[model samples]
Target chain A: MRDIIVVAGKELREIVGAGGGRKGLVRELLFIGIFGLLFPLTQVEAWLSGGVPAAFALMVPLFLVGPHVADSFAGERERGTLETLLATRLPDRSIYFGKILAVCGYAWAVTLLIILASLLALNFGADVSGRGGSPTAGSGESEFFVYPAFVWVAWGVGSIASGLLLASIGTFVSLRSKTVRGAHQAMMIPLFVVILGGSFGIPALFRSLPPSTQERFTELLESMPAVSVVLWAVGGLFVIDLVLLGLGARLFRRDRLISD
Target chain B: MTLAVHTEGLSRRFDGVTALDGLNLAVPTGSIFGFLGPNGAGKTTTIRLLLGLLEPSSGNAVVLGRDVRRESQAIREQVGVLLDSDGLYERLTARQNLDFFARVARLSKGERDARIRALLEEIDLWDRRDDPVADFSRGMKQKLALARAFLHRPSLLFLDEPTAGLDTPAAVGLRSELVSLAREEGVTVFLTTHNLLEAERVCDRVAVIRQGKLLAEGPPEAIRGGGKRKLEVTATGIRPALVARLMNTPEVIGADVDSEGRLILALADGAETAPLIRLMVETGVEVSEARIAEASLEETFLALVDEDLNGRSRVESASGEHPR
Candidate 1:
């Protein structure tokens, strides 16, 4: 356990310090500048009231985690550090889980920062727009914007969980890939499937289903509370995370890792 | 004497091609043992097996009194390894690389800092401790890697080609340090290198392997001494007739006067040097100096490798099989 923390700490430093350290920070600031400040300013009232914040919370961390997950193991292999690390007294599981934790932890932290910045931007924008231009779209009373506690807990924690899931999948692919580029290429397959299928295939499948099946599905979804639906989604993602982690452990063999 | 490493019939084969053949060895504790082999001769493979990084096909090894197969993690904790690869994190500073490995060895905070400080200073890299390894030259990185290997002060260390990329001064310095460390600290060093001269200078016992088979194992002098003795004689008034007479002798296989007026004789097995000298004296040729030239480790290594290649070829020819 101590070894895992040490490895994770070093890995976190490396990830943040990559590209001479300043480049990563610059890129991160660029992200915050765009998504946190500019986008939130334009979406002022809708950012807090609509689903934009939730979607950004999910997708932003996932985007941040993708390259890191690919770089974790494959980067070590490319840099010739994997075999040395493997030969150490550190257990295999520590190295595996340590990298995953580092990736998820960094992405989650950045995602949360982005969300907080977005919230701040929304507050400042709401005040400016309310005083000078127009009141908040629907409500007549213009007041200080405060996101609900549930919103904080939902997106803050939920984005981390989503990052963990993506990181797990990335670990599996990275462990199998010989290079960081190879890992990224391998991860693109799953990313594409998820994006295209979620956007079009699920809806297409709904259209193909008969009226009776569609009505039953709609009734079941409607019967469940919104919180329950979120819980079910979280539960399903956790299950997938566990499966990917298990596969990753099995793939993380000394022979396979050292061979290439 | 206690043994630091013992292997019995250790072998590894990949896809019907043997990378390491059935081999047995006993390396004494606190001795600088050299493992000499050409490329693909399985030096790295042997180190990996002893470190429990790779499983053997049909044999077992004991390192630091622990079974390599079952107690690898324990063995690794107590051993240091510097493979063909330097294994340094290019992005990490020199101090960071050593500190990281020091942590892996589970040193206390004080011990880690102290050791890192002492090692960096000892290797003369403390000045550049903050520079990333990638920014360092090849020699400097090699030096830092060497320092990292000994950072934990393991009882046994496996260094593969420790001086390959080092400049002459750095190589000599590292070689001297290795010798001093082994003698003063009682650290057992298992070094593998193509530098036969370095092996001859530092190794207490050296083993030569060719095509994954152990060719020779003994002290450098012993391995070199096993072959036929060579005698160089400096005399005046020497003629072709004397050389012809010496060549026709039963014990002397070949004789020729070198450019320096020394009669170089290649003696056959079990040849007596006294009788050959007596013949030169009887021929009225004045004999000034007669000394047996000792074979060098490089010559011995070449002879052993050649012998193995010849033996394999003969077997292959007899069996009508293609040589691998």
Candidate 2:
């Protein structure tokens, strides 16, 4: 555990702390501005709604994790630092796991921070518009207009799951990539394909379903509490994460890495 | 003497291309052992196999009394390595790089701090310890890497071409530091290099390898003096008849006229030079100088490699392959 944390600490410093310097912070600020402030401000009603905000929040980890993991895994090989790392006394599992943990942790932190920022932006948007119902106005009688409790649970859990998913996929791509640029290029294509397919294919498949079946599905979904569905999704994601990390473990042997 | 590293019939083959052939060696503890080989020789492969970064194809190795196959992690805990490249983290400050490796070696926080400071000061990079490695020159980076490798105070170190590509002064400085480290700390160093001069200067023992096979292994002086006697004759106006007569002399085993009109002769044991000079004088060769001297490490290495290649060629011609 100490080895893992020590490795992760170095990684955090390299990717998000002083080692990354101003550019890393600037990238995070840009991400926060777009996802946390601008998007939420433009769609206050959608932000409160369950569906769009969940997708919106998932994007934060989806975008952040790929670069971090690709650089952390493949960059070490390309820059030749992995050789020295492998020559150390640390276990291979500790080293590999530590890298994955850092990327996921950083991405998840940024994801949660963005979610909180969006909430503030939404409430602040209300104040800016001189809306009287927001709790931020400091009157106890005023009610807070926020996303429902179920949505909060989905946003937090779903973003974490998304971060883990992206990190796993990045590890797989980085295993064969000789350079970080190659890993980045390889990661970007699949992400775009998933984004495009999820955007177009899911709706098309729903539309293709028989009208009666579609109505029954919608009815069944609406009748279930949002939190129950979220729990199920989270469970599914957790299993997938385990399987992917297992595959990574099988391939991440120290000898094999050096040979490759 | 106790052995720090021992190998018996160690070999590694990649896709039917043998990178390292069956080899046997033993390196004494607390000695600077030089692995001398040209490019494409199996020096790196041997290092990897001994370090257990590579598993052998046929035989096994024991490092620090632990089988590399079963106890590579344990071996790694007590050893340091420097590759051909510096392999430093460019974005991290020099101190951070050392700190990270020190953490891996499980040094206490206080010890790591003091060690890092002392190493930086020793390498004359203390003022720049806080600077990111990418900002430093290659020489500075190499020095910091050396510090990192020594951070845990390992009893043994594997340094692969640590002085390659450095300017003369930097190479000299690094070599001196390496000597000091080994001597002062009682460290056993396995240094690999093609720089014969560097090996000659720094190594207590050297093994010459070519085409994945060791040609010779001994102290540098023994290797230089191992073969038959050699005599160099500097003369003007030496005829081919004179060279032929000298080769036919009882004292001379083989003879050649260098491009500069000097005679290089391989001699039998205890062969006197007076007879050879007398022959040269009789053959209308004005002998200016005749001297017997020990061969340099570079000459000995080249001769060893040349002998191996020529022997291989002869075997190929006589049969289908060579066995050594």
Candidate 3:
């Protein structure tokens, strides 16, 4: 147990000390800040045109969480630190859990920033509209405010799981590859396939509906929610991460590194 | 009385090519055993097998009294290894690299600091201890690697080509340090090298390997002792008849006339030099100079390998198949 923590701590410190921590935090902050400034302008246009304000809420988590979770393992392997971590006496599960925790921590922190930025943007937009004598016309819809919370919860959970799954898969790919570029290229293929499939399936399911049916579908999509889908994705990815952790452990033979 | 490492018929195959073939070794405790082989002669393969990095395809390896494959982790804790290449984490500073491995090895904070300091000083790297290993010279990196291997003070150490890349002075320094380590700490060292002279300098016992088989195993002197002894005899105005007369002696195995027509005799017993000198003077050979030629380890090794190859070919021809 002590060995696991020692190894994990060392790995974490090395990752942080290697400049990944600072670079990632800065990139994430800048991305969120830019997106935050853009959100209110878009939201004001939506309000003036009388479209739903809640639709913009989903983009915040997607933009903030997506990049944070996606680059965790791929970046580490690219830096050549992954093999060094495995050479330690740490158990595979400890490494897997520790990395997942670190990535999730970053993801959650970014998500919180996005939420804060969006709220500030919404408040500023609302105040500007009130001063302009627009009278806050769409204030009756509490769902717009509530939807951001739901999106945060869903994105936070889904991104953590998806990030862990991708990190583990990336680690596995890195183990088989001779270089980081090779590993990154190998990981991108499967990620592209999964993203393409999700884009095609989810949108098509909502399209085949009458006007009344579309309204009912939108209500169901909001109220019934996709938390289960997020949960299922998280659960499936957690298992895959465990299995890949085992494989990465086995593939990390000391002789191979020494010989290389 | 204990054996630090023992292997019997250990063999390893990658795909279809044999890397190590039926190799056996026994290294006694408190001895520096040098493993000598040519390139691609399975030196690294043997070390990997003993370290439990590569499983033997046949037979077994028992290192520090534990089966290598079954108790690899337990054995790993007690064995330090330095491979030919730089295995240190290039991104981390020297201190960080040592500290990280020390933590993994379960050393206490105090012990870790002491060990790291001691090793860095011993390797003469204390001044550069805070620098990243990527900035280190090859010799410095090799020294750091040596320090890391000895960090745990393991009873058994496996060093593969430990001084392969060091300059002459650095190699000499490392050799002296290794010799002192064995004598003072009673550390059992298993070293593999193609440098025969280095092996002859530090090794108490050495095993010569070829094609993954032990060609010869003994002390350096014993291996070098089995070759023919040359006796260079200078006599003033010596004739063929006088040379023939001197060659008739029992101690003289054979005698030949040099280009200057001086007689050179091959002696079966180098110890018979005094008697041969007396006989030469008494026979009026007018002895001017006498010296017994010492056979070198390189010559002995070449002769042994040649004999082994020739014998194998003879056997192959008799059995109607080409030699492997």
- Interface-residue RMSD per candidate? 1.2, 1.6, 4.6
Candidate number with the higher TM-score (2 or 3): 2
CAPRI classification of candidate 2: medium
**Candidate 1, B1-324: lDDT as tens digits:** 899998878998877989888767778899999998888899988998898888888887999999988898999998888888899988778988888899889999999999999988987899999988889998888888898889899999999999988999989999998898889998999999999999999999887787888777777877777655789998887889888988899989877777987889989987889998998899898989999876678877777777887884111111122222
Model 2 lDDT at residue B312? 45
Against the true structure, candidate 3 reaches a TM-score of 0.74
lDDT of 3 by residue, B105-146 (tens): 889999999999988987788998888787898888888888
Give residue A150's lDDT in candidate 2 (0 to 100): 63
lDDT of 3: 0.67
DockQ per candidate, 2 decimals: 0.57, 0.67, 0.22
Over A1-260, each residue of candidate 1 has an lDDT whose tens digit, in order, gives 88889898888878887876467588788888898899988877667663577667666777888888898988888888887888888988889888888888888788778888886887665554443232234454545555544345446666777787788888878887888889999988766665566569879999899999999998998998555665666677678788888888777777567654
Give TM-score, chain B, model 3: 0.82
Stretches > 4 Å off in candidate 3 = A13-147, A154-156, A201-220, A225-260, B167-169, B231-290, B311-324
Give the per-residue lDDT digits (tens) of candidate 2, residues B37-149. 88988998898888888888987788999999999999999999998778898888999999999888888999999999999998889999888898998878877888888
Q: What are the lDDT scores of the predictions, listed in order?
A: 0.81, 0.80, 0.67
TM-score of each candidate's B chain against the true B chain: 0.87, 0.91, 0.82
As a TM-score, model 2 comes out at 0.91
Worst lDDT 10-window in candidate 2 chain B: B313-322
Please report, as a residue range, the 10-residue window in candidate 2 chain A with the lowest summed lDDT. A128-137
lDDT of 3 at B3: 88
Candidate 3: clashing pairs of residues: none
DockQ order of candidates, top first:
2, 1, 3
